[model samples]
Target: MEASAAKAPSTLAKASRERRDIVSGEVMDEARLIRFVVGPEGQVVPDLARKLPGRGLWVAADRVAVETAAKKGLFARAAKAKVQASPGLADQVEMLLRRRLLSALGLARKAGDITSGFEKVSSAIQSGKAAWLIEARDGAADGRRKIMAMARKQQSAPRVFGLFTAEELGLALGGENVIHTAFLAGRAAERWAEDARRLEGFSPLLPEDWREEPIEAKREP
Candidate 1:
């Protein structure tokens, strides 16, 4: 399946942890699993934080796995109760993930850890302060190549994300035609990356080379 690159930030991937996939019956790290909590009203809800009440059920982060869990009554089986499942469960998860990711971006902006615009991003790249580089997928290839060239020159290479379109990125960062942006190294950027990775699994925003894997090892080179 075409998947978005959901690389985790350095703060959360120091060690690998495993969870059971309710659909595939395989054990994998949290990065590869999506948590679901049964709501008070018997509705199934996505709990990326894994802190929601009720027994948590895990499924592979892949959209197909989520759909299978909803379609094949896997959620009900895992919950061990008659639970309400959304036919658009994948869409809902994607929406929630996107919302959380954008909120994180806003937090990064408020913390003064974000830089947008081609010139600014290029500058950040040159300064080597960009720990996370984001480019709009719909943007011009020439511009992307230029920024990426800069990213490659950094001593600590930043994680690059191209999952969102120009309009989507603009809405998140509160600007028009926000084709390129970068997150300076910080806790906010880490949180933003974690959320984006979660959303990538449920959304059709991934590239053809995307793999079904965890975004862990935050401290690794």
Candidate 2:
């Protein structure tokens, strides 16, 4: 019990990053913060990977926070320069994050660290070699339920995420009916988990509360 309690913050510190919201003057973890950088034309751009080279501007992941920051000229003040914040900045961020996640998924497939279809994914989970489970938002209920049940029976359950639709998954993976995807235990899986979590933070539509447990089907209501 002591060890479990001691590890909570350490787990969080490693899973997510921390930054200050320029709009509200509040410190927010990666789960609640969206990072941004100024482009060559002085336009604010969402840095979802946090790899953009420049001073970062952070705001709460909420749409309201992004809208306020752009409308109120808070970014200009934070950067100490005439930076332009697009009125459509929030929409832009969502689009960028969405694409980034799909791209990551594609890369995982190319690296052979991701497998689609129910049978293959189930095998991966049962083998204790899956680090993450991805269910399509439009997948059949029974398929998702069986996968989650398998994940739960594991001694160390893998994490679960449901953020994309069947169509999106199919397009990204170059396949059809991609109801479920299991990320094999490897470097690519780790990278996918990071980007997936960031996308989950920005999009409330994602099933962020789902985990590898014997549970009902997880999806956006």
Candidate 3:
């Protein structure tokens, strides 16, 4: 146990070393930066998984930073070679992040780390077994309000994500009209939460018009 504890600080110290953003020249955690690589055609491609083989050019994950990088030829400058960044590069990155987030949600569902429907979600939240509360963007306002009300009463309310439409959630989770879903507390939930948080950099996790009292949930350290 002593040796295991000793290794953690070293691991964290390594992670503390930040990557430089090609666009802003500012350093930040890799998690907050989007990596890009020059493809065979010399086109800039987002390396969302950071496993693409090649020298990586990083930019802050914000849309404005991505747009600025693409507009200013920052990728080409960083690569020290001719590269093409499509005008829609920011949109492409957003799509990739959304796809990855949904794929993580699908995996969570197959692993039985999620529950759907109003009653099951409500129970999970009330029982303190939920790590995330996913509401369809098109779900009824009344039902969403009631769910949030229950969450507010909990000692530790689950984080909420209401960005996807009912059809999108349904397709990802292999269900029809999956308006309300609860991610059960576990490893699978933790992985999905990380993906969701990453996507939040590109898109709002809640609907733009969602107006209700926020539930204060404990965030990951």
Which candidate should be chosen as best, given TM-score against the real structure? 3
List model 1 lDDT by residue over 32-107, tens digit each.
6789999988889999777887788999877899999999999999989999889899888887777777777766
Better of 2 and 3 by lDDT: 3
Off by over 4 Å in 1: 1-18, 203-221
lDDT of 3 by residue, 12-53 (tens): 887765689998899887877888999999999999899999
TM-score of each: 0.76, 0.74, 0.88
Per-residue lDDT of model 2, residues 1-221, tens digit only: 99999999898877567778998998766656788999999999888777899999998776788999999999999999999999999888778878987898898898888998889999998999988888898777777888888898887677776778999999999998789998888878766665555555456534655443423234321
In model 1, which range of ten residues has the least summed lDDT?
A: 212-221
Steric clashes per prediction: 4, 0, 0
Reference-based lDDT, each prediction: 0.77, 0.80, 0.86
Off by over 4 Å in 2: 1-20, 24-33, 51-54, 60-64, 205-221
Better of 1 and 3 by TM-score: 3
Under the 3 Å rule for N, CA and C atoms, how many clashes does model 1 have? 4
Can you give the lDDT of residue 65 in candidate 2?
Answer: 88
